[model samples]
Target: MLKDFRAFIARGNVLDLAVGVIIGGAFATITKSLTDDIIMPVVGALFGGFDFSSYFIRLGAIPADYKGSVDSYAQLKAAGVPLLGYGEFLTVVINFVILAFIVFLLMRSVNKVIATVEREKAAGTAEPAAEPAEVVLLREIRDELKGRGAVPPTA
Candidate 1:
């Protein structure tokens, strides 16, 4: 069982996927910070200091003086205040869309590179595939035998 487990853990796909997930998680953090810390602030500044994360609807009987920041969400919830967290949701949605677009643009670039390489290959501009010796010999033999009137009986 332990050997089987080890083998499973050592599989190439599993290791690669694990590494990819870790990298993806790290990438997500950076992107999130880019959106929340940098991008949102600029966008907010453009709208005259309108913070996107502060917009929310109060659901409970809590007072309207609740400051709605990231810290405020926890406070409001801790005070047993029922609230609609639409602002946070909107921010998350925007983040997802931005990330997807960036990934799409990256994939588009990679695809273009792949297509260029393929085109080069098709145009014989790339390294040629070497013909097998047996195939070459057979083609030569066939061409030579084609001229012979004496029918070599097909085996």
Candidate 2:
């Protein structure tokens, strides 16, 4: 069983998938950083220096003057406040949309590359150039005449 498991793990697809997962995880971290640390700040600044992340509707009296920049969703929930958490949700939605678009674009390019490779492979073995049917018939006739001791006509 251990040997079988090792063999399974050593398969080409399994190895590729593992590598892809690791690369994807790293890429996700980069994208998350870009979304949170870079893009969102610019987006927030554009809307009259307003950060949507801290904008929430409170249902209970955690504090009437709660600072907009309180850290973490757990804290908000723990504060016993009936909360909308709209800003955080909006941020996450934007991040998802951006990531989705990036993935879509990447997949589009990958598909194009796969298609091109398939097309090239198909082209490689599809067919060699063929003589015209009339030319083939004329060659057969010429060969038959030669076999019959006919003199060849000079072109």
Candidate 3:
């Protein structure tokens, strides 16, 4: 069972998947930072410095013991306030869109490469793979035998 598990882990697909997952996690962090730091700031500047993340609707009253400012979304939320954080949701949506677009572009390029290779193959322009050494050696032996008349030549 351990050997079977090792074999499964050593498979190309499994290794590829593991690498993809790690890259995906790193990519997600980059996307989040891009959305939160660059894009959102630019958008806010365009909209006269209006912060979208602070534009949530308060569904419940602030706690009596809460000392944080009522206008701050993070503070109110930390104070156990029930609020509809649509702005934060919008930021997450933007991040997802950006990530999806990048992935789409990557897939598109990969598909283009695959199509070009297939077309080259169909046109017989692609270089043929080299013959294996064993096959070449066997052919050499056959030629030597045929030259000596030990192996009959084909009609």
Candidate 4:
């Protein structure tokens, strides 16, 4: 069982999957940064600096003893306020869309490169050129003549 486990771990697919997971995790951080730091900021600027993440609706009434201001979503939530966090949801949705688009573009480029490599490999490993039609006909005729003893078969 130990040997079998080791063999399973050593398989090419398993190793590839592990490596892919590690790389994907690292890529996710970069994607998140790109979305949060760059894309969202530009989008916010376009929308007159409105922050989507702080948008929320209070569901439950604020407690009388609550010391924190109910103005901000974070403060209200921290003060145990029931809320519908639509802004945070929208922010997450935007992040997801950006990440998905970036991944799609990356995968498309990778697929194109893979396809190019495959085409090159196929061309490089192609069979030698075929004999011309005239050559084939002449060869067949020579073979028939030789078989009928009308021509000698050359070594």
Candidate 5:
């Protein structure tokens, strides 16, 4: 069972999947940073400094002991106030859209490369496959036999 597990882990697909997952996690972090640090701030500035992440609906009463600002979503949530954080949701949605667009562009480029290679192969512009050694040897023997007149040559 341990050997089987080792073999499964050693498979090319598993290794590729592991690499993809690690890269995907790193890419997601970059996408989130782009959305939060750059895009959201610019968008807020354009819309009269309307911060999306701070917009939330209070569902429950703030605790009496809470000392944080009432308008701050993070503070209200930390104060045990029930709230619907739709602005944060919107920010997450934007991050997802950006990541999806990047992945789409990457796939499109890969597909274009694949199509070009296929076209070259179809047009015989790609390098030809090498013949097997046995076939080459047989063809050499046939040529020698034809040259020596031991085998009939084609007209």
Candidate 6:
């Protein structure tokens, strides 16, 4: 059982999956940062500095002891207030869309390259190989023999 488990873990698919998961986690962090730090800020600036991060609906009443502003989503949440964080959700959704689109474009490019290589391979195999010099010489000799009526021209 242990040997079988070891073999399973040693498989190429398992290793590749592990590496992909690690890379995907790292990629997620970068995408999140890009969305949060760069894209959202630019988008906000374009929309007259409309901040989406603060957009939320209060689901519960603020405690009397809460000193922070009730309008602030972070402050309310930090004060144990229930809130519907639509803005944060929207930001995450946007990040996901961007990441997915980038991955799709990358895959499309890779697939195109693969398809081009496959077509070249297929074309190479479909075309006849150039005849060797000896084969050409033999064919010429046969043609001369046929012209002199020494041998019937074989098709």
What is the clash count for each candidate, in the order shown?
Answer: 0, 0, 0, 0, 0, 0
The lowest-lDDT stretch of 10 consecutive residues in candidate 4 is: 66-75
TM-score for each predicted model, relative to the true structure: 0.65, 0.66, 0.71, 0.73, 0.76, 0.80
Candidate with the larger TM-score of 3 and 5? 5
Ranking according to TM-score, highest score first = 6, 5, 4, 3, 2, 1
Q: Write the per-residue lDDT of candidate 2 for residues 27-54, one digit (tens) a residue.
A: 8888889999999889988988878777
- Candidate 3, residues 12-89, lDDT tens digits: the string is 999999999999999899888988899889999998999888889999988889898888999999888999999989
| Candidate 4 lDDT, 30-113, residue by residue in tens | 988998899888999999998887899999999999887667888888888999999999988988888889889999999999
**TM-score between model 5 and native:** 0.76
TM-score of 3: 0.71
Q: Which residue segments of model 5 deviate by more than 4 Å? A: 125-155
Model 2 segments beyond 4 Å from truth?
58-84, 131-155
Every candidate's CA RMSD: 8.6, 5.7, 8.2, 4.9, 7.0, 5.6
- Between candidates 2 and 3, the one scoring higher on lDDT is 3
RMSD (CA, angstroms), candidate 3 = 8.2
Q: What local lDDT score does residue 11 receive in model 1, on the 0 to 100 scale? A: 100
Off by over 4 Å in 4: 1-6, 130-155
Candidate 1 error regions (>4 Å): 63-74, 121-155
Residue pairs in clash, model 5: none
lDDT of each: 0.83, 0.83, 0.92, 0.91, 0.92, 0.92
Measured with C-alpha atoms, the lDDT of residue 117 in candidate 6 is 100
Query: Residues 46-101, candidate 5, lDDT per residue (tens digit)?
Result: 99999898989999998889888999999898878999999989988888898999
State in Å the error of residue 61, model 5.
1.5
